[model samples]
Target: MTTVNADAATPTELNVLVRPLPDYPDAERAYSRSSSLLWRRSAGAVEILHPWTERTISDSVMVASLSELVELGVLSGQEQFEDAAVQMICSSAASEESAWRAYYLNSINELDNGTSPFSPVHRRARSLIAGHEVLEVGCCFGFFALACARDGHSVRACDISPGAIDLLTTASASLRIDVDACVGNALALPYPDDHVDTVTLIHLLEHLDVQDTTVAVTEALRVARHRVVIAVPFEEEPTEHFGHLLRLTEDDLRLWADRVDHAGAEIFTDHGGWLILTPHR
Candidate 1:
């Protein structure tokens, strides 16, 4: 019978009695093997022969096995922790949020057949321009302009990008949506004073610099006889990213609206990233 000395064995010596299965390979096999060999070489160090073979366990062996199992579990948890940390760092570096937003916007435009994501903006613009002429600033590809024209409103759309203007013109011809689409700057709008019944500025305010934004707003006011519908991203805080030239908080919009109202424009506030200012006719 093999002499089982439970009291003489340390935790490390008892751990040697249980070997991991051979089916799953480990990258640290060399280190593990070397450590096992060093422990086995010691004199009076509870010899664990054929540790891979199943055998009945003494109380000491059972206690040692339990301790070893706990240590292994801790080490495995640590490895998982490290892996999760690495993944988080990689995600932060990749700017995943911005990528997802861009992907969502592109997908919506492609899947929705060139409709604006904000339906409220579309509806409000249509209502404000019902049986009236409208001008759209920064009308890239003329989606909103075409929508208004299709609804029987005379539409004039302008964009800074020549390519966008050309695309808008081609689309107009194909859709048979009569629209005056041109390439023009918002700061120097190519329209006479009090010409249009409504001016629509969708997602345009945040792109303009301070001077340009003021000038563009003034130009829109000058061109519109009735109302100017403007929409921008809801500003929670000032952000350098997202092409935000100047973050317009609700307070900022109110202040500007007051100025426009003083200039004979009656500003109407609407929730959901939109503001409609009707000029006193």
Candidate 2:
């Protein structure tokens, strides 16, 4: 939910420029002056270099999750962060889109790899898909949609975030993968009733309130001919960085199924909690 707004004082056409860190005038002083400077330590810690907001983030779960991408050179360096922030401030529409596209293109290489954290989750989700026509709701960057397409499923995906949809669209075209991705709300899905065989709300419900979650599940069930698949992270407390608002347990998922008009509900745990809701004919 990061919104980038361009300052009226800055030039719309201005592109971010990178210079050697050592050559910059009094690097320490410059870091103090600029609020956007981020420094990466050799020990693998990230330090936000704002004068009043200097803090070193520990090697927590979030850092560990992204470490593989960094090691694989899929993630950007410190300089890129500075540049990207400048781009976001100066010319957000084009630059933000470009940033997302670049990240998607780079990260997809390791996304489905055996060692990747995402690999097992996606593999399990892919196996649970019941039919040929699939729709993945809240498919950020459409990685699963791409995987489904590779499996010969007529895959489509949508997300609430415009930047995410744009990234997915750009990556699908670049990889020559056919996935119809668009920007749409989960509560009010854009597809018609029984439009696809399976509708998946992968890691999406945690971001929604209880009311919206019910509406989203209802919408998915309505749109899916066979079943609706839901996956959520099992957390004691929701992680704010990931924009998670609710910590969903196995019982929570079962309760959700009870509230819906599903023929049956099968709940389990793999990397996270998995709930398969079979729609009534």
Candidate 3:
């Protein structure tokens, strides 16, 4: 665990919430186990834990008191952070056992919200772009990419998953958002040097191992001419086998930003897991 900086601003408060699935025993066990580990790690340190249990392992943690965490970071605004954290918890839980497909399906099906949990961060990044060409690595279902395109920014969305790319393309067409979606990898971006004005990555960096993350950051710098926007989950403790290679903290992100800055790029944290890095022209 990274040591908290005494000189830096401290988090405001911490809270936790839990919800148990009665039908899914395996899920309940997994959730309980993971939540316990997190709680034990974050105990009595400006954090709150919420546990929801139905049958066995009824004592389990579900949601977190995120506002305090944000306050600790010297950030304000609660509703957005709360929403993002819940979505992240759900996404992480679902991803624990290949639940992303179901999660994505449910998100798309329930479009009544128009704004997914990532909407706040996505909207923030979109607001920064004043009609610029944007590139999204690992676009998933093109949710954020489509949002950018719909906002009148030309977007090139790419993902290693062909099915994801196809779905994004199809969805973009239906929404009348002009976007170029492709199948590609983050390490070897399928774009020319300095081709895009902005590069947006949501919950992407931590998906790779440390070494791979370094390589991907290099590639993102290589392709992006102006800015790089990234969002990661800010968890108190490490969860076992988060489907990806590793989990990251603000320190990790700061180190990555330093690397980019050494390479002549400027990095800025946009609260929580969102970062905005701009390269020198």
lDDT of each: 0.55, 0.66, 0.57
For residues 124-161, could you state the per-residue lDDT of candidate 2 as single tens digits? Answer: 88889998999999996687888788789999999998
Q: Write the per-residue lDDT of candidate 3 for residues 1-281, one digit (tens) a residue.
A: 12345653333443333232333444432331322322211442322233322111110111223333333342224333444344434434434223333333344333324334444556666776633899999887776776676667889999987967976676566556688999999989999888898887777776677877777877877788887777777666433223334566777887887765423433345544666677666
TM-score of 1: 0.54
- Where's the lowest-lDDT run of ten residues in candidate 2? 50-59
lDDT per residue as tens, model 1, 54-109: 22222122223332332333112322322322222222222533322332233224
The prediction achieving the highest lDDT against the true structure is 2
**Clash count (model 1, backbone only):** 0
Sorted on lDDT, best first, the list reads 2, 3, 1
Candidate 3 Cα misplacement greater than 4 A, ranges: 1-115, 237-242, 261-271
Give candidate 1's error at residue 24 in angstroms: 35
Model 2: per-residue Cα lDDT at residue 138: 93
Clashes of 3: 19
Q: List where candidate 1 sits over 4 angstroms from the true fold.
A: 1-116, 237-242, 261-271
Superposing all C-alpha atoms, what RMSD in Å does each candidate have to the true structure?
Answer: 21.7, 10.0, 12.1
